[model samples]
Target: MFNRKHLEAILITRTELRLPRTTPEAVGIRSTAIAALLDAWKESGLELHSMMILRHGQVAAEGWWAPYAPELSHMLFSLSKSFTSSAIGLAAAEGLLSLDDAVISFFPEVAPEEPSANLSAMRVRHLLMMGTGHEEDTMGPLSSAEDGDWVRAFLQVPVGREPGTHFVYNSGATYMLSAILQKVSGVKLLDYLRPRLLDPLGITEGTWESCPRGIHTGGWGLMLTTESIAKFGQLYLQRGVWEGKRILSEEWVNEATSKQIHNGDDEANDWTQGYGYQFWRCRNGAYRGDGAFGQFCIVLPEKDTVIALTSGTNDMQGVLNGIWTHLLPALTEDVTADPAAHEALSDKLGSLTLEPPVLDAASPLESEVSGSRYVLDENQFQWTALSVQFESQEAVVTLENCEGEFVLRCGRGEWAEGRGVLLQGAPFQRGANHRMASSFTWRDSETLSITLRYIETPFYVTSELKFNGDELTAQQQVNVAFFSPELPSLHGRRS
Candidate 1:
């Protein structure tokens, strides 16, 4: 039960989620292998968010780190570039546009009277290969610009070299292709690719961040379930064939996977495996779509395998190093039937689970926020800009600095337990945990109040909650990250 539905659409057909032929009886891996792999993976000190192994197309093994579920969607970061590249391929196959089309074609109205020669020479292919020859980085300049116009501005930058002569990781360049796709197709990148690829592949629940004009952020801001990421890898593994249908032409896939661009001296260079359209070459002779904080869709051609993972890490290259070192050695060219190993592995794999949320670890969490009690409102709440709110089933509690409100219902009778958990605005925004502690209490039997506490203790986040009827408020204190301090206290009562 490794559920990647929230992280990405990982649908391995019962037929595809099989172990190597040498291993029958049960497709599950050996218990020893599972222990060794997890030990090796965690040894790096980086949390393993989601991991999937496809053996001859079947899911051989899968797992997740604590507080992270196979169902939760993790941000794809720059690995988003690969999806954007695939969208272009799907669009090209449908005759919506051509890869060789001029870069200027997408925005005749936006280009300057005297466009740079390098700008004129750039093509869709160039964008896919990170050969745009523009600025070395993207998000910096484009962050504040309008969505429709951002691509053109990116194209206008001075050329670092001739269009195809150099290889730089240009996120803005990827964003431009994403922008161009919308401009010409007359539709968002997600919508266009939804039916052609996502729906067919059963990739659902993917989230894309949008710019002011409502275009999905092309180079980044994609969140996918772990399963969805795996589907992408499998699609690449099968050369674009799925369920007896050819979603993308093998030619396009071959071209995209081939080294169309040259990267640098590092081990994971695009040039090493030879850059394809949007994919880069990995150390294992594999082509991969990777993102910041370690989101990866790695397709191993020679090994006839695929490994898709979503992680939060500062060192991406080191993440791959862990896989290459431990997992690679687990494979053997000499195949043999090992039914006992497979069964034991399957049982061990089944043991992995995420701990349930502690609703009442602190006895103080048990109380009823009742009646309309106007407690002391702190001027400190107005210090931050984030919206915050607090509420109770039979009580009124109000807070400043909060943009949203949460209402708590009594679980039992007069001695009802706390309501739901209160998390901050959003988690993963600053690459940190969402920290909020919420509890409720009843006041005068006519009103209820809630208090949320937050503390980020450098290494992790801890929270405390206190609720009394006369006053309704909450405090967010984090030990890990320092968010703009905002305090919002409000009381809720049946009106």
Candidate 2:
């Protein structure tokens, strides 16, 4: 368990203003190109939350979709692997550990009594490069370990191949990196990088979820603003020097981002390009640290650009395709500003919004269901009862579940702020305060539809409540999920 003082010390606030904001045209990218990019993404139905483009060390164009504000930090998912790699690089530079160190050496007590030859030879570098030699991903066993000893569980997994000879996208290996960093440095991954990396970058608000043992889950569960991601990409682009100070050795930067392993042979697929130290090589002489559901921090050395994006879509490749198709080819050194195009781009950015439901007109059933309570039957959520109170422009929904009763608000034709938990019984840890932005619409005369977006993570649930006289039927479906997106329908009676 983490000490309270140490957990509290994970937070440190200081703003270092260095990334100057500028127009796309000033940076050699046409403003009309950016406007077109947004239009194309919208046309493709890609649920992008925010985007930040940096060229020549300056922010060229940045915008956040409605309800995804600049201040809000987004979940990084596997992109957290890149940050964990950075911490490992720092630890190596400090001489606390070496990449050549054997993985079992860090946790000698938990290591197998008689390790296999492949497991014994597994080195720290193998973990960074996704070359741990395990035939399959070890994440499944690591997560479901009943004993809660992740280190032991990981070590017990059979290493089927020689270390550094193969590649499997094993998230558990990244977790071991975090466990090693904490074991050697006696601090969490975020805390260890605070002074060396985060402070210099002016990343004040960030959090990394921890494992059962209180070690930071290095493979995922990191949250930071879009600007922070941009700064990190810029730092890597600048060869680990931040504001003229060398935060990381130039040698480490080269090694970490360079192609370290062969992942696949499909030249057309971006993911098949190559794998680095927790980074992925891109098609256009670029490298990136990306996450599930389309979170990205792409660094283009050839173009001298960095593009950061947060999105909620299953089509991760589609998001990258939009960047390559629209934003990349137009990046030139020639400066030519189209005033009219710039004005249009600015207006487009300012007015960018996710359209709320169109069928928001007041329903005939609104008066009949207003302030009425429904006692739901047996369900997975343990939601015993639900009530909706309608107002002129919003509807207040209250639900009583196993956790307790909670209230949420859905705007009639816009997004309204609210709070609720998601995937409560799931394996991952839930934040103490999970926020939501809900929009409600009358799908028909008898059905009330609501879209609840968990703002911090890439998840949105569409719930439909159908009222038929003395009974009600409710169904919920998520936009994207690892498992089934549709949940079992629920029936209830007016109480």
Candidate 3:
């Protein structure tokens, strides 16, 4: 849990001068490039979805693509590592542990009876720097182990290079931090960070998934509103102070954001910016936290700016180059608003909203099956829902299809209440690739469906919901093969 006094400290505190959206840019940005960037972003097909720009602590520019909204919590991907690193700093401040401490100190039992030089020499700092010397462990192979053996599994991996001598982009290393933080702090990462970070920033609630070991996945599984990521960038922009509270020490910020390793030196990667604790350096002096597809919170000290972005996969290099070639040039020390142009630009920024997912026109079948019923239409093409309750004004559904089962409550969109499930396997703590893009399209009154489409493999899946009261049926289909394998469609209409 978050420290109570810290939570109380910021609860009623107020800022003397609230930050404004736009700083007085003496030679303000060129209004023309703003539209140009948007066009280029879309034309490039980089799956660029939402953007928020803060200049001098105000929302200088912000916008979201259709379907994507400011309110939705986006996957941070690798960007989550930065938060993990920040938590390390916070824990250090609280005297929970120090980065310099030996990682084995937290898990003394994980070391082998006779450890290798690298294994014995490994420290917590190396893990933060992606220099853990693990030969090869990706996509959470460590997670498959018994919860208690996870750390041991990681430690047992042979060191390909000396600890702290090589820079390997390792998500597994970050997971260990999540595990170790829990071990040392005696609290889960999100809950521990709530008052210390979230509550202070006004993020009242969010869901962060835990690994099989039940530790918050430090390297991934963090979901935050696009705006919240912007706030984090803002906090870093102010060097870790928010609304007058010193959240993190300056020393931690300097070390974490500074280039700790040249990660992509041989790989010829976009992280051309270099790697810090969990942050990647940008072309200029800016640093950012990024995820798969596209989730970014780029902070530039020289420009006194922060840009928070969420996106789907298309092209990452294009996104970075677009920002640099277009947006960066516009960031002048003196930016005077073209009143005529400013209105349009303001209209452009912070504009766009998702239309409510509405049920389509009713049909004869829809009226007939308005309540619920047991559906065992196809054996392999099977769908069954449990707890298929219907309120006068709502639809409650919990269903399992070939792909997976999700419990959705929608008073508004697809779900009967506030919950929802994607036709694809839900987002997992393993990595960024696990994210699913589920969009809803109501087929008829009796059937509402969502498609779980992946940017990569395991793509193109559809889930159809058939409604009745005590019995409900759903169908899941993958657009992969001409003939998908027959599945034994389990049948049990949830009462």
Candidate 4:
């Protein structure tokens, strides 16, 4: 049986034993330089979740913000495309498929009765390089198909230009690549790559979201540990060789990482440099596989380094900028051992955490509304009632929504961990038993503010409950979302 937990699983180990840990000086970089990079990232106010810097196949420096530990799997969004590309490379090596094979040939049943010239010319290589000729992304239509036939829906999308002559970041194209791989291999993408790729790297745990047809969503929704991401980057940096054995052909790695098409003209922007097979070319002759909202596996071949990072921020460019500004310089220069700097860097990395809600005194309204259930007006969320109870140092809130009752224990200016229904809707799975951390603070005399962090994913929710006499007004918003971040407000009266 297919388990939903495996698709969005969270591991609970505390130690990172998969990779060798070492001092920054052993990797040709000063410990202070890494500390400085951390300082710069903190100053920029990016919501970084985890970071792992590796050089010479050794973990030089690594850290995870509180609640976002090394054991937990972080969502990789579009970064999964690179893994799908790897599967394609492996399949090609086994003669299961070819780069030049016509994509339409894989699914003749789903193909349009009369395929266009552009669509017929589309090849597996075009999908790998994001050179599909569609004028825009086909995801919108592909996702909204009533029958859930994504392959057929994708094939029907008109190709606006010649496949090899135009470049469009089409995720549906990636999905087609996944469907083709499954068609040729007779198994799921993850299972097919497990023994050949993931197992060789000691990555035994992972999950990929599947489509309605049980195919993995090739372009997004992959979850893996920070260390697992580093291992992947390290493998690519070493030309697909792991432990003196070649897991992937050097020919495939070279062709995949080399710039296959020009993307833009901006010399300063990283996205414009060029594009390879499921990889983005970087400014300093490096390449990377990056996802939306800042999940990155950056490989710097010239410097022999790989940096894995996971974060939640609107400014993806800001992250790469910080890396270029501080971390890039340290990679090239030689530095002597400084025990004091190494100790300082270690301490800083050890203590890294995202600040919780601000500490504030309890509002007098807490006593009046304590244990009182508020009967809420009908809203889109279908929340019918809400109740709050205060204790010695924590606040427990009970909410009744469409999914039934959800109880959250929030610490006062600190995080309280628990497993319960994830109240944030849409992109997040709506069910119980999701790992989360929460903190609450009194914003004013009558307002109670709370922060909910879904630790396994790059998302958090901020809610405010305001009380006036017998009336209650509740407002909630997510930090980032595929849907609208501004959720509907609820008005209610004490019951």
lDDT of each: 0.61, 0.88, 0.66, 0.87
Of 1 and 3, which scores higher on TM-score?
Answer: 3
Over 307-364, each residue of candidate 1 has an lDDT whose tens digit, in order, gives: 8887655566777777677676565445455767667666655554323223332233
TM-score of each: 0.72, 0.95, 0.74, 0.95
Cα lDDT tens digits for candidate 3, 42-153: 6775656677778778876667654344445666677788888888889988998888887777887667787777777888888888888776654456766665466677
lDDT value for candidate 3?
A: 0.66
Between prediction 1 and prediction 2, which has the larger TM-score? 2
Show where candidate 4 strays beyond 4 Å: 1-17, 424-426, 431-433
Q: Per-residue lDDT tens digits of candidate 2, residues 1-495?
A: 112233123233433454788888888999878888899999999999999999999998888777777777899999999999999999999999999999999999999999999999999999999999999889899889998889999999999999999999999999999999999999999999899899888887789988888999999999998889999999999999988899999999999999999999987789989899999999989899999899999999999999999998999988888888888888999968788998888888766667677695689788889999999998877789999999998999998887688898888888887666774533234545876788899889999999888878888888899999989999888887778888778799999
Q: Which pairs clash inside model 2? A: none
Model 3 residue runs over 4 Å out of place are 1-19, 23-27, 146-148, 266-269, 350-419, 424-495
- Give candidate 2 regions above 4 Å deviation: 1-18, 423-431
Best candidate according to lDDT: 2
Candidate 1 TM-score, C-alpha based: 0.72
Model 4, span 1-495: residue lDDT tens: 112233223353534437888989988988877888888888988889999999988999998888677777888999899999999999999999999999999999889989999999999999999998899999999899999999999999989899877778989988988999999999999999899999889897788888889998899978898999999999999999999999999999999999998899898898998899999999989999999878999999999999999998878888999989888888855678889999999888877788787957587778888999999998877779999999877899998976578788988887787777666453575653567888899999889999989888888888899999899998989887777888778899998
Model 1 lDDT, full chain set: 0.61
